[model samples]
Target: MYGAETWRTTTTTIKKVQIFINSCLRKILNIHWPDTISNSLLWERTNQLPAEEGIRKRRWKWIGYTFRKSSNCIARQALTWNPEGKR
Candidate 1:
């Protein structure tokens, strides 16, 4: 539950949120869910890419290249924001 207020109840909610986010991203990118082996290989490849290449390069090379710039910005903001409103 990772420090959630109610461990047992929150776990299910967390899983559902994760699944929903994953599905949304997949649909937005028009990509299939990766198999276990492919997923591992993808992480390995991502690590090999240069950090200086920036988000656009990585997003295009790995994630769906078709994502609009503004959508990516909004997604990044949503992911990085804390629920408590603290930086």
Candidate 2:
């Protein structure tokens, strides 16, 4: 009787479980296509163009948590956080 009850529960839940697992696997294996525009000479010309006033004035915030410490140490850590200079 116990085995029969467990079998019934598992059969009822199997479809829902399979759907959830497939959805998760789909996202995990998702692919991103490369930008064709960025591959062209137009992309190079755009990059070489001077920054507009608004673009130049825009300030990027440093992301990541700050602990209670000396300002100098925090500043140094922020600088070293992304040596590749990614925003």
Q: What's each prediction's TM-score? A: 0.29, 0.25
| Residue-level lDDT tens digits of model 1 in 1-87 | 133321333456655654554454445545674632343344354453222223335445533422334555765455456687568
Cand. 2 TM to true fold: 0.25
> Model 1 TM-score?
0.29
Model 1 steric clash pairs: none
Candidate 1 yields a Cα-based lDDT of 0.44
| Candidate 2, RMSD to the unseen true structure | 22.1
Model 2 CA lDDT for position 24: 44
What tens-digit string does per-residue lDDT give for candidate 2 at 1-87? Answer: 112212323444645644444444434445224432332233244343212211222312122323344556855476457556567
Residue 78 shift from truth in candidate 1, angstroms: 27
Off by over 4 Å in 2: 1-8, 31-87
Q: How many residue pairs clash in each candidate?
A: 0, 0
